[model samples]
Target: MKASPTRVHHAPARALLAATLLSLSAGCTGASPDAEARPQASCAYVIEYDSRTYLGREETDVPVGESLGSATRPACDDTPGDGDDGEGRALMTAFAVKGVDPAVAIAVAEDPGAYRLVVADTVTELPPELRKVTDGS
Candidate 1:
């Protein structure tokens, strides 16, 4: 007797796809050890130094000499809170980790560098490594 023509089971293919996704997820989580507690503040923050305006947050902005204070650059944001507030926290979690556009990042600040920042809540001190290094601090 002859057998009828039919498709074979796709279980192996489906299983492979599942395994790949799981491995990818595991790798991502282990990529950064300090990623969990780190603040989700915009790495793309705007900057205004000595009347000169610049785009994006710079690692060298926070002065490590002379004094310690917050608001190294005026951060004009509609969501005032830095992922510590209700709205900012919710927006970050819903969109980023979930991989869904549950919230939209509105143009929070217009003319970003034009505002003055009053440091409150936290006292930001300069990093110890840059104590002797002066970039017009």
Candidate 2:
């Protein structure tokens, strides 16, 4: 039996199409190269009254090492009878700062107030070593 000429040509076309698709799909799976190259912007942060150990990033251009002066504290809803007035509570306050110089971070940490250094882009919690420093332990 003789093979059709059209069938031979179709085999190569199908292989080429599959290879192109596989390459395109692989490119989409991982972090973009430019994402690593770009620097993220730093923002000012105020710690909530509830979680005094970690700093939450705020959308402000306040320079590092400067006080976040006059920022409103996060409401303490979980505390009993704390009320919306936010008084009569022990009131924890800290600034979790990231993407700043080490010296600046230390200075901020050394402040008598509560402040913790968090890993960049992951403001979930303060690292143990930083917690010790901030806590003055």
Candidate 3:
């Protein structure tokens, strides 16, 4: 039997369409290969405490279109006081980081020295003040 010209023309188109559909289906099952390694979007906040007292706080948002950036600020309420004078008030520092996780963020905000970097699971000391050195864009 002789193949029709129309059938031959449609054969290639059908094969291309099938291939495209297959690739798209595989992608829908789960995230891309690089998705696991990519950084997630998150916001960070700086919670300042003075001798275990809630002094003040600052929110630092990642710039639009960026995934991560350093955030720092000096204490806003630096009033002179002993804060709490219990038998054990182990927290005295004024600066702490409170990153994205809800529970952890709340704990950090309430307690002293709970710094979290939203991009990773590691915690470190409070970041240095990122002072504004220039006023130009």
Candidate 4:
């Protein structure tokens, strides 16, 4: 039996496709050394710092060691209530953990930083390790 022209072409194409898939799978499993240098933020949550609370979900990556601007008009109150009230203003020196009722999907803070996010009736802190450290230096 003679092989059709399409069959012959497909044989080499199949091999090429298999090789390409294998390479892609391998790359996905383990990142190259260069890619590891810059770690990517997988999740984000709201953070209240320096008398200002920032909605982490709004930003792709949480700003660490940086001051976050007020996301609301007239600024948010510094009373440290359950999240923003929309009209309260906050000073620039106070730092507190304001619990946002809405479960804002957020990744864990890198290091030496922590925040609280409310999911339903439960409040969760990412990277759990942050709790181990004390309030003082």
Q: Write the per-residue lDDT of candidate 1 for residues 1-137, one digit (tens) a residue.
A: 65556857789999999999999898868347766655444433533322333342222222211111121335344434345432222111000111111121101122322221211122244233322232323
The TM-scores of all predictions, comma-separated, are: 0.29, 0.22, 0.22, 0.24
List model 2 lDDT by residue over 1-137, tens digit each. Answer: 99886765678889999999999998865477675344333333433322233343322322235544322333443334323333322333224343443322322332354444432333345455445444532
**Candidate 4 structure, TM-score to reference:** 0.24
User: Which residue pairs does candidate 1 place in steric collision?
Assistant: none
The deviation in Å at residue 134 for candidate 1 is: 23
lDDT of 1: 0.32
TM-score preference between candidates 1 and 4, better one: 1
Considering TM-score, where higher is better, how would the candidates rank from best to worst?
1, 4, 3, 2
Per-residue lDDT tens digits for candidate 3, residues 57-79, read 23232211222222233333322
Clashing pairs in 3: none
Model 3: weakest 10-residue lDDT segment is 128-137
Estimate the TM-score for candidate 1. 0.29
Q: Comparing 2 and 3 by lDDT, which wins?
A: 2
Every candidate's lDDT: 0.32, 0.41, 0.32, 0.36
Clashes of each: 0, 2, 0, 8
lDDT of 3 at 11: 85
Q: Tell me, by TM-score, which candidate is best.
A: 1
Give candidate 3 misplaced runs (Cα > 4 Å). Answer: 1-8, 31-137
Worst 10 residues of 4 by lDDT: 93-102
